[model samples]
Each structure stands twice: as C-alpha cells, then as structure tokens.
Target: MTTLPPDETSQAATPAIDEPLERLARFAFDWADTLCDPDHGCGPYHRAWSMIRLLTKNSALPAGGAFIADGLHRAASGGRCRVLLAGAADTGLVALVLNALRAQEIEPEIVLADRCATTIEQNRLFARHLGMRFELHRCDISALTCRPVDAVVMHSFLNFLPVPARQAMIDALSRALRPGGLLIAHQRLDVGRRKHDPQPIKENRALLESAARARGYPDPLARAIGAAGADFWSNTFAHAPTPEAEFLVLLANAGFNLISLSRPLAAATNSPLFIAGQSRETPQAAILAERMPPR
Candidate 1:
C-alpha cells in the first residue's frame, strides 16, 4: 500500500462534487429523449443515437458483458437467480446486464438498490417503460440486511466510499452471496506517471505546481508532485487501473475464488475494472483481516 502525504490546503480547495454523475445522467437522458423526439434535427439525434448504438452494440458484449453475463449464466443453469444491483442509479448498467441475460433466455430477479430518491424514481420509471420487474430499495447499502443472493454486481460504487467503508461494503456484498454464488465488481485503477509526446511530464507537473501555489500552499513543487502521485495511484491502482495482484488478494481475503479477470483488449480508453469471483464455503475471514496500506 502506497501512502501519499496529505495536502490540507489542496484537500480543502477541492469541493465535494457529484457534477460528473449528474452530467452523465443528464447526457444519457437528454440524448435518449432527443433521439426519440420526432421534431429534433436528424443530425443531432442521428449522431447521439449512433453513439448509444455503438455503446450497446452486441459485438462488444464479449468483453463488456462477460463479468455480469458469467454470473447470470451460472445462475441460469441453476433455474433461478436473484441478483442485487448495488447503487444502480439510472439503471444504465442494469439495462446492459438484463439485456445480456435476456439474450440468453434467463429471467433474473433483480433488486436495484440506491439511496437517491430521484435516482430511484428514474430507475422505476425506466423499468416501467421497459416492462421489467425489479425491487427498488431507496436506502444506504450499509443499512441493508444481508440475504442469500445468487449474484451481486457493483459498478463504480466502491471507489466513492472511504477505505474502511469500502472494505465493509465488500464484506457485506460477499456475505450476501450464497456459497458458490458470484460477485461482480467494477472499480477504477490509478495509473503511474508516464511520458507523453503531445503533453510532456514537465508541463503537466509545472501546471499542477502552479495550481497548488495559487491555492496558497507552501513548497508547491513538492506538494504538486505528491498530489499528482497520489491522484495517479488512487485512479490507477486503487480505483480505476486496479492491478491483478491487488484484485486477487482482495478476493482471497473476501473468501472468494477467482473465476475470471479481464481488462480492456482495445487501445487505452476510459473503462471500468471488471472482476468476477465466487463465494467459498470456507470463508477466508483471516485474509480479510490482513491490513492493506492506505490509498
């Protein structure tokens, strides 16, 4: 575990913002609505529709749908499968997962969980529009009771929680799965500093240093480097670019047997870390107890 020195001023400067999430939701809804509106210019709707089409293209399912489909397929073989979608705001991932399962002729009982009332309403509306059945729980995941589920899929939710909260959430998710059941989670990993042709490290570091100094920080250069390093590790290692080693260790600790691990095959682009594992009969609580270095 790598630890980066805390930058109090920098931390204070960065406000808690959910603008990214809201922007994404707005984009999706706006794009979909525009495309469906008959009066809209063909150009705008065409371009947006094409993008959504490309995003959900079946050809990409092999890699994009593998984690969720693997669990769904396993549950399908057993005749009945109950799936839990933690923090399934807007049901974007849920739509994909359900589409994949439906393609395989598997009817999965889904429980969509999230604390946001607006998001819950949106999910319910979408589900109604699609004529699909799902139980929506408007509550924090931590407050929920653990029950036997065939699978649990968490997409980009763990990273928002602090380390301890993340660990507890993982433990809860693991316990929710029945023995031999599947757990699919997607996280972001942090990538290390690398030289770029168009954008050199010197320029990037200098810009960061300037930002730190502007925020009234002392030793801005060192502080900038430390901040950049922390961001890189958190995004690449802890959240986005999660290493296989760390993932394996995490699964082992959670009493899960690794079934498959996959990364994007295409050239580097923004993508989620896809992982799948199975709950074990003999819980590995000891492994979970092993302390990991701070992020």
Candidate 2:
C-alpha cells in the first residue's frame, strides 16, 4: 500500500492529538527497542508496542470510529450505555466511544479489558484526559466473564487470535453482554488462513518504511521504530484471521445476528501476503451485530 498523505487524509479531523500520539509513539518505540535488544523473543504484541507505532503511522483515527459512534447512537435509548471494550492498544477507541456517548447525552458505563499492562496504562492516558470513569481489566478477554453489558466493542483484535480462540472470545463476549447486546468491531477476513502461515518481513519493509517516512514523527529515537519493526518483525501477524463466512457463522453460533457489515474507505487489513500461489489479502470490514435473546 502506498503511503497516504496524513494531511490529505483524516488526521486533520482530530486536532491536538498529535502531542499524545507522539508520546505514545515514543513510548512504544522504546519498548519495541527493549524487545529487540537480544532478539524478537519478547513478542511485538507483548505490550502491543508495535501496534502503537503502526497505528500512529499508518492511520489517523481508529478505522472503527464511525461504527462506534453509530452503534452507540443506535443503541442508546435515552439511558446509560453500558459498554465493554474487549481489547485495546490505545485510547482512540475508548475516546471515540466516550465522545460519542457524551454527544448523545448518554452516560456510559464502560469496562475496558486487555492482557497487556502497558496498553492498559496507555489507555489510562485518555481516561485521565477525558475525565471519564472507566473500569479496567488486565486479562485474556476470552476467559473474561462479567455481568451482561449493553455492547462489546473491539478494533482489529480478532485477527490476533487463532480461529478457535477467536470463536471462544466471541462466545465469551457474548455471555458478557445482555441479551440483544451489540458486538461491534473492525476485522480482517479471508479464506483458508492459518496461524502457521509464513509472513516474511521483506514483503512489509517497503510499506513500513514508507509509512515511517510519511509520519515524520518529531522524536528522532522513535523515528527509527519503523525500521526496527521491519527488522524484528517475528511478532507481526503471529496469528491468522478468520474467513468471512466462518466469521459470520461464529457470530451466529454465539447467538449474534448481524446488523451491518461493510468495508470503510481507506481501511486495510494486515494479512497481505502470498504463499504457494494462495493469496492472503484479507480485507477489513466494520461489523455491528446483536446477540439474540434466548427464547
């Protein structure tokens, strides 16, 4: 993918976020550097440091920002909107949800869950900024259980898990929501994908380098993270995405009914590779689903 000019894109829509985005990018760069001191063994998603840089460099606002806004507006019935964020690497989604809820005059009861402490702390930055109350959890979201909420939100998270775990996560999140609760997310999908698929850094180096240069981050040390990521990319795409049909089946088996699913403009998926003539160009789609109440 050729680099889209940030100024020519949607970055201008979110003003004054450059400062926080820089701080987060710098922190992620330092952490990624630590993961590479001896080797890439620590895993890029260990603290989701890789994602912070990639997100800051490749995309301005979260791709699911519009879905989050519309979902909340659709679900809010002049009452508090209870939400559960299944996983997050930054404050963008949470901030978007909060801002959208506020616009609807709906008080939000939000619970944000993730396994990485760094990301949990990273998400806290926005909580502090928005001055919104948030209940945070550091754990595998697939194993998470709680009182049913009104909706569950995520952004490109299902691809991080193998297909079985991905389904388990859907089931778990389904149980966490009240009957007829919403499941909203942006996910990459294609056919015949597997976790053991080979993903060479060579394929992504050009894309990474282009993004790194386009972002032109102010911090010099952090600026090198794109190169570092290209070199130490063992953890990049360590998992596989679900097939589109299988994903729909999983949601259905988990008692969810599809509300809407569509690919948004300028949004891309991570599974862009070719192995043995089989293409892995998984595309991203914005999904809004509702869990069916037991009869």
Candidate 3:
C-alpha cells in the first residue's frame, strides 16, 4: 500500500443544522466513541454483548467490509484509485476496509464523510492505527458537495434523510462517481404492512427478550425492556418508514443501474445490501411513470 499525509479537513463550509439534530449527532458520536474506541476499556461491542452488538449492527461490519473490498477490486486501480467511504461511525468497519485494501495491495485516496465531529476524529484515529490516510468531510450527507471518485460506500446512513433530500443526495453521489464506478449501499426497507406501523413494538420486544437471554438477565429485566418498546422505537427512529419503491425510484432518478439487491432478512433485517453501478449507458428516465403512486 502507498502512503500519503492524512487530511482531516472538510472542503465545504459547515452547513447549518437544527439544534436537536446537532445534539443527537453529538450524543451518537459520544456513544460510538465510548463503546467502540480501542483506547477505552471494555467497549460493549468489543465485548460482544448481544444486546448492544445486535442493536448497533456490529456483527455486520465484516461482511460489509468484504462486500466493499470486492467492489474496490473490480474497480482495479491499484493504489491510485479514489474512493469515498460514507457513514462508517458505529464499528471497526473502517479498519476492516483498510486491512482488505492492504491485502489487495491498493492504497486508494479515501474520503470519509460524516456529520459528527467526534466520529470524524474516531475515523482519523482508526486510520492512524491502520497506517492509512483519508480526507474527512464533516457535514451531513444532504449538504455534501460532490467530487469525482472511483467508488462510494454508503451503509444504512441515507435513510435518516427525508425522501426528497434522500433523492437529492443520491443524485449528488451518482454525479460524484466516475463513469462505471461502483456504489455499495445498505438500507433497511420500509415495505409491507406490519403489526405496528412506525413503532415496531413486537420486534423490539423480541429483541429485548433475545438480548436478555444473551446477557443472562433475569425475567424482571427482560420484562422491563420488553415494556419499553414504544419508548425505544421513538427514541431510536421516530420517522415513518420509507416505502421500498421510493428508494428504488430515487436510485433510478439518480442515474444508477442497480446491479444487485440482497433479499431483506426476515423482518429482523434492518438493512439489506445493494450494489449499483454508475451506468456506462445513458440513464433511462426514472421509472416513476411505471409505478403506482405511493399511498
């Protein structure tokens, strides 16, 4: 792998964010740093406690990293490629990517994107630990300015944006990619009717039960967690689910050709992986006309 000076600066000016979002992002950054930081002792995810690990999706990082590495290999530019890794704050996913790239003998110029300042700092530390270099873009995805790159890795991150903004972000990302470049995105589908519309109380209850079992918790603790399903869902993801079709249409409108979309795991699957290509062919007009209007 080749070496270069790491740049931790954002090219764009700081975008305005609401105070609530700002606080939430900070809290999320602190939570991640506390649980995943190598300098910190007994990081919960590091310890593999089932509740936190499952809640945070730490177990999926290895597979996600391999999927990204495969795409990078196909791009095939050795150490000279430029790649963007977006939305990687929760786990050691960056470290996994760095190791995979090293094994392939490729040291691409990397740009790491996140809204959280501490998350950006954590990424810098991981790069130092891995001896890799990256430029940090410290702004929300919706506010990002596009730059051409060979590949982009987005993992279960864009869902937080409102629908229109999500589409705009995808369009920007597509424009940012070099022709024939790859984009790997993992998103949780909000499709089909369920027992709960926005509040996944049933699922949360199951998760609590499983978590309790994993931690060898007594029945009382399990009952308490199970009872807090509404609060958990509200605090975690308060937005209404995005219809899966909306997501596909957004990609189509952004001029990407969907290459593969993994089957969503049982309702348990939070995000299913999608690999797409910036079309070498002309982008067909978005398929909006072909689908029924959203309910």
lDDT of 3 by residue, 1-295 (tens): 1221221111111212111222232234235435444542223222222233233332333234444566677664646667777765433445445545666888667777766555566566645654666788877665677577777777555645655567777776776677777777644456321223343445555665566566566677556544443333333322355565777778777777776655322222222111011111111111111111123
Local distance difference test values of all predictions, in order = 0.46, 0.62, 0.49
The CA lDDT at 95 in model 1 is: 61
- Candidate 2 residue-wise lDDT, 72-141, digit = tens: 7776655788899988756656666776677678888879887766566666665666565678887788
Candidate order by lDDT, decreasing, is: 2, 3, 1
What digit string (tens of lDDT, one per residue) describes model 1 on residues 139-181? 6676666566777777655544545555556666667677767
In Å, residue 276's CA in model 1 sits off its true spot by 31
Model 3: runs farther than 4 Å from truth?
Answer: 1-63, 191-234, 264-295
TM-score, prediction 1 = 0.52
For each candidate in turn, the TM-score is 0.52, 0.71, 0.56
Per-candidate clash tally: 12, 0, 0
* RMSD to true structure for each model, in Å: 16.3, 6.6, 13.9
